[model samples]
Target: MPFLGLQRQLGIDLDSWLLRQSAAQPHGKAGACHAFEREWVECGHGLGQTRARRECQPEYEDFMECMHRTKLAARLKKILDQRDKMIKEGKYTPPDYQKSQEEPRP
Candidate 1:
Protein backbone atom coordinates (compact mmCIF):
# COMPACT_ATOMS: atom_id res chain seq x y z
CA MET A 1 0.00 0.00 0.00
CA PRO A 2 1.03 3.62 -0.55
CA PHE A 3 2.57 5.26 2.60
CA LEU A 4 -0.04 8.06 2.90
CA GLY A 5 -2.89 5.62 2.24
CA LEU A 6 -1.67 3.27 4.99
CA GLN A 7 -1.32 6.16 7.45
CA ARG A 8 -4.84 7.37 6.65
CA GLN A 9 -6.28 3.88 7.14
CA LEU A 10 -4.51 3.49 10.50
CA GLY A 11 -5.69 6.97 11.69
CA ILE A 12 -9.28 6.23 10.67
CA ASP A 13 -9.22 2.85 12.46
CA LEU A 14 -7.80 4.47 15.64
CA ASP A 15 -10.49 7.18 15.63
CA SER A 16 -13.22 4.59 15.11
CA TRP A 17 -11.89 2.44 17.98
CA LEU A 18 -11.77 5.46 20.33
CA LEU A 19 -15.28 6.56 19.32
CA ARG A 20 -16.63 3.06 19.99
CA GLN A 21 -14.98 2.89 23.41
CA SER A 22 -16.37 6.32 24.35
CA ALA A 23 -19.85 5.40 23.15
CA ALA A 24 -19.98 1.89 24.69
CA GLN A 25 -18.50 3.02 28.05
CA PRO A 26 -18.91 -0.57 29.41
CA HIS A 27 -22.02 -1.28 31.56
CA GLY A 28 -22.46 -0.30 35.26
CA LYS A 29 -19.66 2.29 35.17
CA ALA A 30 -20.13 5.45 37.21
CA GLY A 31 -20.85 8.38 34.90
CA ALA A 32 -18.36 10.85 36.40
CA CYS A 33 -14.90 10.18 37.86
CA HIS A 34 -15.11 12.97 40.46
CA ALA A 35 -18.49 11.78 41.69
CA PHE A 36 -17.23 8.18 41.86
CA GLU A 37 -14.14 9.34 43.76
CA ARG A 38 -16.29 11.21 46.23
CA GLU A 39 -18.49 8.12 46.69
CA TRP A 40 -15.45 5.96 47.34
CA VAL A 41 -14.08 8.55 49.75
CA GLU A 42 -17.40 8.63 51.56
CA CYS A 43 -17.09 4.91 52.18
CA GLY A 44 -13.74 5.29 54.05
CA HIS A 45 -12.59 7.88 56.68
CA GLY A 46 -14.15 9.91 59.52
CA LEU A 47 -13.87 13.13 57.46
CA GLY A 48 -15.36 11.32 54.50
CA GLN A 49 -18.25 10.16 56.69
CA THR A 50 -18.93 13.72 57.89
CA ARG A 51 -18.78 15.10 54.37
CA ALA A 52 -20.97 12.33 53.04
CA ARG A 53 -23.49 12.84 55.83
CA ARG A 54 -23.66 16.55 55.11
CA GLU A 55 -24.09 15.95 51.40
CA CYS A 56 -26.61 13.14 51.87
CA GLN A 57 -28.81 14.88 54.43
CA PRO A 58 -30.30 17.15 51.80
CA GLU A 59 -30.99 14.21 49.53
CA TYR A 60 -32.79 12.45 52.36
CA GLU A 61 -34.75 15.60 53.20
CA ASP A 62 -35.69 16.06 49.56
CA PHE A 63 -36.82 12.45 49.31
CA MET A 64 -38.94 12.81 52.44
CA GLU A 65 -40.44 16.01 51.12
CA CYS A 66 -41.33 14.30 47.86
CA MET A 67 -43.03 11.48 49.76
CA HIS A 68 -44.91 13.98 51.92
CA ARG A 69 -46.03 15.97 48.91
CA THR A 70 -47.17 12.87 47.07
CA LYS A 71 -49.14 11.69 50.08
CA LEU A 72 -50.71 15.11 50.51
CA ALA A 73 -51.67 15.25 46.82
CA ALA A 74 -53.23 11.80 47.00
CA ARG A 75 -55.20 12.74 50.08
CA LEU A 76 -56.37 15.97 48.43
CA LYS A 77 -57.45 14.04 45.34
CA LYS A 78 -59.43 11.58 47.52
CA ILE A 79 -61.12 14.46 49.35
CA LEU A 80 -62.03 16.08 46.05
CA ASP A 81 -63.48 12.82 44.79
CA GLN A 82 -65.56 12.45 47.96
CA ARG A 83 -66.76 16.01 47.55
CA ASP A 84 -67.81 15.25 43.97
CA LYS A 85 -69.69 12.15 45.15
CA MET A 86 -71.47 14.14 47.85
CA ILE A 87 -72.47 16.74 45.29
CA LYS A 88 -73.86 14.03 42.99
CA GLU A 89 -75.89 12.59 45.93
CA GLY A 90 -77.39 16.05 46.69
CA LYS A 91 -75.62 16.14 50.05
CA TYR A 92 -73.39 19.03 48.95
CA THR A 93 -74.01 22.15 46.92
CA PRO A 94 -71.19 24.02 45.20
CA PRO A 95 -71.20 27.79 45.46
CA ASP A 96 -73.51 29.56 42.98
CA TYR A 97 -71.82 30.84 39.83
CA GLN A 98 -71.17 34.55 40.27
CA LYS A 99 -71.00 36.24 36.87
CA SER A 100 -68.66 39.17 37.26
CA GLN A 101 -70.34 42.43 36.07
CA GLU A 102 -67.01 43.29 34.38
CA GLU A 103 -63.62 41.71 33.85
CA PRO A 104 -61.11 43.15 36.34
CA ARG A 105 -58.58 45.43 34.66
CA PRO A 106 -55.33 43.52 34.29
Candidate 2:
Protein backbone atom coordinates (compact mmCIF):
# COMPACT_ATOMS: atom_id res chain seq x y z
CA MET A 1 0.00 0.00 0.00
CA PRO A 2 2.90 2.35 0.64
CA PHE A 3 4.02 2.43 -3.01
CA LEU A 4 0.50 2.19 -4.43
CA GLY A 5 0.65 5.75 -5.81
CA LEU A 6 4.07 5.19 -7.40
CA GLN A 7 2.90 1.87 -8.83
CA ARG A 8 -0.15 3.56 -10.34
CA GLN A 9 2.00 6.36 -11.80
CA LEU A 10 4.36 3.80 -13.39
CA GLY A 11 1.40 1.61 -14.56
CA ILE A 12 3.12 -1.41 -13.00
CA ASP A 13 0.93 -3.68 -10.87
CA LEU A 14 1.93 -6.49 -8.47
CA ASP A 15 1.56 -9.18 -11.17
CA SER A 16 3.82 -7.36 -13.63
CA TRP A 17 6.38 -6.67 -10.92
CA LEU A 18 6.40 -10.35 -9.94
CA LEU A 19 6.74 -11.34 -13.60
CA ARG A 20 9.69 -8.99 -14.04
CA GLN A 21 11.39 -10.37 -10.93
CA SER A 22 10.91 -13.94 -12.08
CA ALA A 23 12.19 -13.11 -15.56
CA ALA A 24 15.38 -11.78 -13.97
CA GLN A 25 16.00 -15.17 -12.36
CA PRO A 26 18.14 -17.80 -14.10
CA HIS A 27 15.44 -20.46 -14.63
CA GLY A 28 12.32 -18.29 -14.68
CA LYS A 29 9.22 -18.59 -16.93
CA ALA A 30 11.10 -17.42 -20.02
CA GLY A 31 13.79 -20.09 -19.61
CA ALA A 32 14.80 -21.85 -22.83
CA CYS A 33 14.86 -25.33 -21.26
CA HIS A 34 11.36 -25.20 -19.82
CA ALA A 35 10.21 -28.43 -21.47
CA PHE A 36 13.13 -30.37 -20.03
CA GLU A 37 12.68 -28.66 -16.65
CA ARG A 38 9.00 -29.62 -16.62
CA GLU A 39 9.86 -33.19 -17.41
CA TRP A 40 12.39 -33.31 -14.58
CA VAL A 41 10.01 -31.71 -12.09
CA GLU A 42 7.10 -33.97 -13.01
CA CYS A 43 9.31 -37.03 -12.83
CA GLY A 44 10.47 -36.18 -9.31
CA HIS A 45 7.16 -34.93 -7.96
CA GLY A 46 5.32 -36.98 -5.27
CA LEU A 47 8.12 -39.46 -4.79
CA GLY A 48 10.58 -40.27 -2.04
CA GLN A 49 13.93 -38.55 -2.32
CA THR A 50 15.82 -41.72 -3.23
CA ARG A 51 13.17 -42.89 -5.66
CA ALA A 52 13.01 -39.51 -7.33
CA ARG A 53 16.79 -39.39 -7.64
CA ARG A 54 16.88 -42.72 -9.37
CA GLU A 55 13.80 -42.34 -11.54
CA CYS A 56 14.41 -38.79 -12.64
CA GLN A 57 18.06 -39.17 -13.51
CA PRO A 58 17.47 -39.12 -17.26
CA GLU A 59 15.12 -36.16 -17.09
CA TYR A 60 17.55 -34.31 -14.86
CA GLU A 61 20.41 -35.04 -17.25
CA ASP A 62 18.36 -33.77 -20.19
CA PHE A 63 17.47 -30.61 -18.32
CA MET A 64 21.07 -30.01 -17.33
CA GLU A 65 22.25 -30.54 -20.90
CA CYS A 66 19.70 -28.06 -22.18
CA MET A 67 20.63 -25.54 -19.51
CA HIS A 68 24.34 -25.86 -20.24
CA ARG A 69 23.82 -25.60 -24.03
CA THR A 70 26.89 -27.74 -24.75
CA LYS A 71 25.34 -29.55 -27.69
CA LEU A 72 23.68 -26.43 -29.01
CA ALA A 73 26.94 -24.53 -28.91
CA ALA A 74 28.80 -27.25 -30.77
CA ARG A 75 26.12 -27.50 -33.45
CA LEU A 76 26.03 -23.73 -33.83
CA LYS A 77 29.82 -23.61 -34.19
CA LYS A 78 29.75 -26.28 -36.89
CA ILE A 79 27.03 -24.46 -38.82
CA LEU A 80 28.89 -21.15 -38.60
CA ASP A 81 32.13 -22.73 -39.79
CA GLN A 82 30.34 -24.28 -42.76
CA ARG A 83 28.73 -20.98 -43.63
CA ASP A 84 32.07 -19.19 -43.45
CA LYS A 85 33.68 -21.79 -45.70
CA MET A 86 30.87 -21.43 -48.21
CA ILE A 87 31.19 -17.67 -48.15
CA LYS A 88 35.00 -17.86 -48.65
CA GLU A 89 34.50 -20.22 -51.62
CA GLY A 90 31.95 -17.91 -53.24
CA LYS A 91 29.32 -20.64 -52.91
CA TYR A 92 27.12 -18.66 -50.54
CA THR A 93 24.81 -16.18 -52.24
CA PRO A 94 23.91 -12.98 -50.45
CA PRO A 95 20.31 -12.72 -49.27
CA ASP A 96 17.80 -10.63 -51.23
CA TYR A 97 17.99 -7.87 -48.66
CA GLN A 98 21.77 -7.66 -49.03
CA LYS A 99 21.50 -7.73 -52.86
CA SER A 100 18.86 -4.99 -52.81
CA GLN A 101 20.99 -2.86 -50.51
CA GLU A 102 23.95 -3.20 -52.87
CA GLU A 103 21.89 -1.98 -55.87
CA PRO A 104 20.06 1.34 -56.27
CA ARG A 105 16.28 1.43 -55.80
CA PRO A 106 14.38 1.64 -59.09
Model 2 per-residue lDDT at 87: 85
Q: Model 2, residue 3: displacement in angstroms?
A: 40
Model 1 misplacement above 4 A: 1-62, 66-68, 97-106
Candidate 2: what lDDT?
0.71
**What are the clash counts of all predictions, listed in order?**
0, 0
Give the TM-scores of the predictions, in the order they appear.
Answer: 0.32, 0.42
Poorest 10 consecutive residues of model 1 by lDDT?
Answer: 15-24
Report the C-alpha lDDT of model 2 over 1-106, residue by residue, as the tens digit: 2254787788765533433222445544555766677677667767868999999999989987877888889999999899889989999976877654656589
Assess the local accuracy of residue 7 in candidate 2 as a C-alpha lDDT between 0 and 100. 75
TM-score of 2: 0.42
lDDT of 1 by residue, 7-29 (tens): 58666444224322223245756
The local lDDT score (0 to 100) that residue 18 gets in candidate 2 is 38
Task: Show where candidate 2 strays beyond 4 Å.
Answer: 1-35, 41-57, 96-106
